[model samples]
Target: MSGMGSKMLELDDEDELKDFRACFVDDRSGVNYLDGNSLGRLSRAARDSIMTAIDQEWGVELIRGWEHWGELSFAIGDTLAAELLGAASGQVVVADSTSVNLYKVIMAAHSLVPDRRVLLADLNDFPTDRYILEGIAKANRMELRFIATAMDEPVVADDFAPYLDDDVAVVVLSQVNYRSGALNDLAQIAYTVHSVGAMLVGDLSHSVGAVPIALDDDDIDFAVGCTYKYLNGGPGSPAFLYARRRLQAELTQPIWGWFSARDQFTMAPGYEPVAGIGRFLVGTPPVLQLRALEGALTVVCEAGIERLRAKSLRQTELAIELFEQVLAPHGFRLASPRLGPERGGHVSFEHPHAQELTSILLRDHRVLVDYRAPNRVRFAPSPLYTSFAQVYEGIMALAKAVES
Candidate 1:
């Protein structure tokens, strides 16, 4: 290792949270892991919890497993709200995929503002987001408005200001922009949307466990996110939904599922929406998938989101420093914001050879980071499992990759 790289490792050794790194099993030894923003390391808690559920709950109980399976969604949802979501229990539910949840809330939010014929969105927001709104508009025969742009930059706060009128149904955006890691000022934007009588929705896919969020305090009408990232719930884990309490009664969902009926098991002939956020649920939920997230949340709540966030900031700061000190000379322009508060738990940098460089680092250097289109590399500091040493080692490997 270079003298600077060795010092970065020593800097990590002095950290108090360094010992927590051993809690995860790693076959990618001699590699640096910086991909936690995309997928987090499986925690020992998740591993043990899943095994116990399989062996004791499902294996032994079998048909009698309905009791444990039923409350798993709400139970986990309660913990997420109390610890991470910053809302009351009934406000959040682990159900369906993110796209499904987004569709449910988008249509329902429109219903609340009947005359609103336009849907405003970021042209550069995640592709799925833009596509979803387009589909919504096509279904309703409305216009999809893009934020005004000049000099090739995206629409900022001013662009949103002009569009905030009663005619707009819902304004959708990412809480933390996916590709750029730019954090939108949610509370301010939420207030703005409400002032103009529009519902505000955020896709927290990149922010939820990576940063602190308060859906209730912000008076956000709706929100959705994938759990596979920082939640470490494993691939295809159940995504979560949040519908503000005040709007719960006014909004009606598109899908009418048995689990969401007033008396779900009565075999009711007609659809009567159940009270509270449960009405948003559709179809029979996958208990097995919910169980994985349940186990993961156990670890997350135990550690406290506040502590995790603090460590996350430190880790990202260190990674950026190492890049500026070591990799910047080799040809990497910081893609993520330098101001910590404005960015999420991840950092991205531009490298002309990013795609091929990622392949070389993963195959030869054992350093793990992901590449987006064009020329960008994203490094996530998943506080629950990532450590300062990994950041130091990963960047040093990147510096080597740049040379090779």
Candidate 2:
């Protein structure tokens, strides 16, 4: 180990959350994994649970497992709601992908106020979100308005005040910016949207699990997020959506699969949607993937989201400190918020050759950080398994890559 590695180990020795690292499978011993914001590292619990789901649930119980499997989506969703999202039990359901969930909620929002002819969204939201909003706007013949925000600045409630009006039916925003890790104030944005009689559709894909979210308390009209990222649910794990209980009766999603039918087994001719959050379900749940997510969520619940959030803030602060001390002198600039509370779990830096440097770090040095478009390298030190020592080593590797 190098001098920086020794110092990092000293910091890790003092970290109270160091025990949590044992829960994950650390196969790449020499590689520092820093892309948890894009895809979380799989935990050992998730591995064992998936095996049980395959061997015991499928191999032995067979089709009979559907009896309990049928409710896994809602059950797991309720767990996520209570543990991660500050939401009510009957308000959230796990189903579909983030794009599909967004489509359902956006359509529901449009149906509520059919006369409104404009849809509002952030100009720099994730590409999939922007694509969904574009399709919705084109399909409904409604005008789409985007709020231009600074790359490094968080989007606050005041940012929407100038653009919001009676004509805007829905305001779509991401709780955290994917590239910069800037955290938006959900409560204030929800209030601002409601004040203009517009529904707020939040994309919590990057915020949930990494940061604390209060969907119900904030009065968020609709929200969608994926389980594959910070949730550590494996690749392509099912996504979840939240629809406030009060809005369930009035909202109607476009998809009308058997799962969402009032009496699913009836094989009914007409499509009668179920009451509450179940109405958002489109088709049969993915049992294997759901099981994987349940296992991962079990770990998250055990650790406590609040504790995870505290540690995440601390890790990010340390990463920023290291960047300022080492990488900043090498022409790298901070692209995320300087304040811990104002940012999410990741720390990003803008360099002229960020993409090339990211490749060099991965290929030559075994450091793993992801690069965003243009010139940004993002490092996410997951609180669950990532150690402060790893963050220090990753930055040192980045410094070497810059020099090379």
Candidate 3:
């Protein structure tokens, strides 16, 4: 074998998470998948757990399953908090979509600082986040201000310096840029926002499972993320929301449902929202999806986020290295940060024909990648399942496709 191939083998062998590949279902269709940052591969544990829930819990237990299912969201949330997110128990819950959760948390945080009339967010933020904030600001007669930054650049405290003020009640940010994969300094940004007496609401969908987050240590007031991507909970899986324990008491999410009611089983007439994280929940929890997510979380917890982060850095480093050696010469410009610490688990390359190239790679080259907007192709090297060999092969395939 060539030196590069040998190196790939050596790296794969040295990987502590290599054994985790077998824990997930193998993709035997001869396709190289590099889009886990968009949607992670299905894990065997999640599949088996979902099946068991269908057969035993829903099939046999039926209505009685509510006994345990009622608290599953909290249990899973605590697991996510302790394992992936650096947060405490009773501060996170698995329920609703990221958009819904963001809406709830943003609205709740806004209420806390009703005197402030402006809400701030990055202009290039994910569509759902921007939209949610926009709607909230418009309906509540508040101004929605945006911090303009390059798509490939990380949003820093300095970037928000012009926008930070006491009038800025809430500042929304993504832990990692979805398009360029640029990781933000959450702690520093949080301090800046808080100094201005503004709350920080982070959208962690793109970084949750792939990156390390310290919600409590960072002093993030509110955050939301989806499980379908790096969490590998399957499509449309339940997302999670986090509210600082100190803020939970005063925060009241706009959504008021039986599930959020205090003594919810009482089905009482009045809407007295629960005291803790459960108050953010709107309606019935998606039991089957939560079970699948619970199963997926077990793998993440067992592998350890610190270990996962180390592997992620190595994988993204290799990806950028390979891209520079091969694809860069083929009119592919690096869109994401060249430094690993400033980036997430993915690397993005910008090409004029990114959309066409993406389709060609998927259909002809049998390499799975995803494209964004006018000209960006993203490769997510999931640390748990993706091997170094696959990363090499995926980039090489892209080179060949571009050259053709």
Cα lDDT listed for each candidate:
0.82, 0.91, 0.91
Candidate 3 backbone collisions, by pair:
none
Model 1, span 1-404: residue lDDT tens: 47766776776677655655666666456667788878877877677777878898889999798876878778888888889988998989889988888989999898888888989988778788888899989988998988833311222567699867778889998888776687777888888888888898889998988789999888888999999898988888888999988889988798889888998888989999999988988887877778778777777776677878788888888888888888899989888777778878788888899999889889998888999877888888788777676787788788888888
User: Per-candidate TM vs. native?
Assistant: 0.94, 0.98, 0.98
> C-alpha displacement of 266 in model 3, angstroms?
2.8
TM-score of structure candidate 1: 0.94
TM-score, prediction 2: 0.98
Candidate 2 positional error at 139, Å: 0.9
Candidate 3: 10-residue stretch with minimal lDDT? 147-156
**How many residue pairs collide in each prediction?**
0, 0, 0
Error of 3 at 29 (Å): 3.0
Measured with C-alpha atoms, the lDDT of residue 142 in candidate 2 is 88
- Candidate 2 total steric clashes: 0
CA lDDT for candidate 1: 0.82
* Global Cα lDDT for candidate 2: 0.91
